[model samples]
Target: MANVAAILGDVVEGDRIFSPTSLHLPEFLPAEAVVYPTTEAELAAVMACAHQHRWRVVPTGSGSKLAWGGIGAGVDLIVSTARLNQVIDHAVGDMTLTAQAGAKLADLAPLLAQHNQFLAVDPAYPDRATLGGIVATADTGSLRQRYGGLRDMLIGISFVRYDGQVAKAGGRVVKNVAGYDLMKLLTGSYGTLGVIAQLTFRLYPRQEASKTVVATGTADAVAALAGELRRSPLTPVSFDLLSPALANALGYGEQFAVLARFQSIAAGVDEQVQALSALVGASLTHQILGDDEDENIWAAAGKALFPQPEAAGQTVLAKVGLPSDRAIAWLAQLPSGSLARIHASSGLGTVRWAATTAEDVEKLRFTVADLSRAGVEGTSGYLTLLEAPLSLKQSVDVWGYGGNALSVMKALKAQFDPGNSLSPGRFVGGL
Candidate 1:
């Protein structure tokens, strides 16, 4: 502790250094102390000190997702980017923006909206999730159907290496193809590689109007509509498949549902809505939501996968990916009380439920294994236990990644963090 204080000098005096007891962090993160670095240089210095002492450090922003991923063996210190919140620049003409990693997505919304532009991502907990945290977790929501993943919107990034050196990749421009693609590599690295410092993203213009069409019916009927919409010429910003539990929560009946959102000029949005309505016809019950109703529905959808603050301790949240055509079948296999929202086109989505005991969660894992075995040929399903109790996490692998690239991932981890000092074992395959 004295050594770290000496290394930081007056920069970390007074309340800047926090005892582990003061914060409500996860049990896996047994941090001795947490430090807030106000600048990139300060962050680098902290990392350097940790490197010299061989201290295991965990990097975080607002600690919104600190409980996610596999539990690391040990943690000596926590490096937080909360104090580094700053928007460096907004290149409106080029439709690009650069901001410190600690900047909250919610705060950036109105700022970007001033110019009729947005970051084109719908990550979880916008008010508390930071730019760096979102990129690190890769929590982009259904918006990926139209705007793509965070890796596509991220044009540039700067991060502090394990050895405390500042490094950068990509650039401020959207067309830069120079050097290695670290942006993609670090986007979902879960802080195992380094601590994200700053980020640059390509922005998109806000549409003039928006409408959401929700159609509810049997799984087969909804799947058929999803297939038809995918083959049609209409463009939807979000195309999602809602499980019976989730649909019921959103005021739809206890049936599988397909929800699509279209955003464009008023006439274009109306035209597409009419086209989709025609396709839906009398075969399935459907509704067109606009204005406040449309916005409220989507907001509620994002919140559905997360437990309320009071229920956070008893809830479990997991992400699942499978063949697009098999999503309905997979949803049908989930536990009775579970709520799920899977992307109809990409087959990636979250499943959440409340469990009073670890045994309940273990049963869910068994169900996942059965579904993986039943998947289509050449395509296996996988699930990641994103948020859960420490007991459940310790019993099961958080990231159920059974892929062939693990050896390569281990090699990269060894190269980037030879000491395994940065968020050790929190990433895939415990890299």
Candidate 2:
């Protein structure tokens, strides 16, 4: 550690480098040091040093979603993008913004709001979540139903390879080169491909008005309404099916409810709200939410999506993916007390429940396995435990299945990080 610090002179701080004990990093992966870089050049220098030493490096941003992905096998250095945070450009006319990778969405959001534009992706922990972390994790929230996720919003990226080569793909403009497609390759790679330095994303104009319509019914009925909304002309920015537990948590009287968010001109929003209410009709009671009420409900739902317990072992969270049409059926398969918030249109869902006993861990393992088997047998689904007790993590494969893409993923990893210096084993198929 001292040798690398000395090599970088005063640029690297010895105090910041330490073992990975603070963040929710894999307990099994022992990190020798954590280096903080304020600039891309410094990041490249550190990575080059690590590569020369053959030390495995794990690039991180805020450590918010560090525990995601497979278990890291030999992580020696933690390269953090803490101080490299800045809004490099905001071409409002072009509806695009470029920011340093470490810039938190929380900070960037307010700036964009000033210009009547905003990034569409909405992940949890916005206050602490950095742009690089969000992109690396490919995290998205309910807003994805309307604007799509990070993959769609991102237009350009700059990254430092394991060998310290700085590379970029795409550009500030919407149109770009055709080959490589590095933007898509690195977006959700969990930082295994390269250390993301800067990102350029297309922005959306803030809607003139917004409203959320809430409706309650049985799972089948809620699914039917969700299906109807998809087929109808009503354009909701977010269409979510809330679990009974989650619905109750959000202060809804019913156990199951559908929350639809509309954003457009005031008149259009009003029309969509009325049409949505009529679609539910007598089958379910509906309510058009005031701005305050709408914010409160969506805020609660976001918290539920990434629940943080007051104490350890209080909750276990997992992400599930299924066919949009089979979401209800899949929800029915979960054990009672399990709570979920699902994107009705995307078929992506997140499940959470209290972790009270060893039995619960076993049940979770079984559930993940069952979902994996279903995907294999043509049901087309997947389940991944995102947060859990260390004991529970050790007991099962958090990533249920890798599928046939495992080989190709492995080949890509070998080509990009043959030295295994970039987030080793912290990827699909343990790449």
Candidate 3:
């Protein structure tokens, strides 16, 4: 501890460094000290010191997702980008924005709104989730149905490597793509590759109007509507399949439901809403929400599935990926108390619940295994445990991936951090 403080003392202020005991961190990560670096250079210096001493480091931003992924063996130092929050540039004309890793999404929203532009990804906890953390976790919400994931919006990235060397990839402009696609590589590396320092993301013009059409009915009826909407020409920003519990929580009755949100010119949005309502017909009860009602519904749905600051250790959260056609069936198979919100087109979303016993974990694991066997041909279905009690995490593999990419991922991890000095054993296959 003394050695770490002495080495990094000159890089950052003494008040910016503290003992790990002062913060609420996961028990699996036994970090000696936590340091907040205000600039990319200061962060690079800290990484260099840790590399020289072969000290394992865990990179974080606000520590919101520190408990995600696998439990690490241990960490000697924790480096945070909390103080590195800053908007580097906002090229309004170019439709791109560059910012520091610690800049919260919530803070960027209003700024972009002022220019009638916004980042297209809808990640969890915008109030506290930073650009780096959102990219690291790949937590893009249902907006992915239209705008794609964070990797798609991200045009460039800068990070401090394990050896304390700063590295960059891509360019600020959306058209620049001359180098290795490290932007995508580092997007979901879980900080096992490097510490994200800054990012540049492509932005979209804010729509003039927005509306959501929510339809509630039996699983078959909702699935029919979802299929019809996908085949239609209507473009929705969000198309999510709500599980029974999630639907009930959203005041939509305890049944399967699908929520489709459209954003465009006022006339366009109104036409699409009416078209969707016509498709709903008499098969299912439906409602069209506009203005504040539309925004509130989406916010409530996001909060229900995403991990919150208050539900840290007491709840279990998992990311589910399956065949889009089988999403309704998959939701139907989930445990009774579980709440889920999955993207209807991409078949990716979150499932969460308050788990109390070992039996509950086993049952969920069995359910996942059964579903995996029934997935589409040549595609692997997976359920990654994102957040849960330490005991449950220890008992089950957090990443239940049984694909053939383990060897390749291991090689990449070895090449990135040879000494295993960055967030060790916290990624897939213990990469």
Best by TM-score: 3
Q: Give the TM-score of candidate 2.
A: 0.92
Instruction: State every prediction's TM-score relative to the real structure.
Output: 0.95, 0.92, 0.96
Report the C-alpha lDDT of model 1 over 205-316, residue by residue, as the tens digit. Answer: 9999999999999888887888889899999999999999999999887899999999999999999999999899466899999999999999998887764555555778
Tens-digit lDDT track for model 2 on 1-431?
Answer: 55544554554565545546545565756676677778788888888888878888888888877766666687777888978898999999999999999999989988999999999987967778899999998887889999998989898999999999999888898776655789889978988999999999999999998999999878878878888998998889998888877787778764678999999999999999988888895767778996788778888787766754443245778787776666666666666767788898888878887765656655655654556455456553667767776676666676776467888888888888888789887777666
Q: For candidate 1, give the lDDT of residue 159.
A: 97
Ordered by TM-score, highest first, the candidates read: 3, 1, 2
Q: How big is the positional error of residue 365 in model 3, measured in Å on the Cα after superposition? A: 4.4
User: What lDDT would each prediction earn against the true structure?
Assistant: 0.86, 0.80, 0.87
Q: After the best TM-score superposition of candidate 3, give how far the Cα of residue 116 lies from its true spot, in angstroms.
A: 0.4
Q: Residue 369 of model 3: what lDDT?
A: 58
Model 3 CA deviation exceeding 4 Å by range: 1-3, 21-23, 356-359, 365-369, 372-375
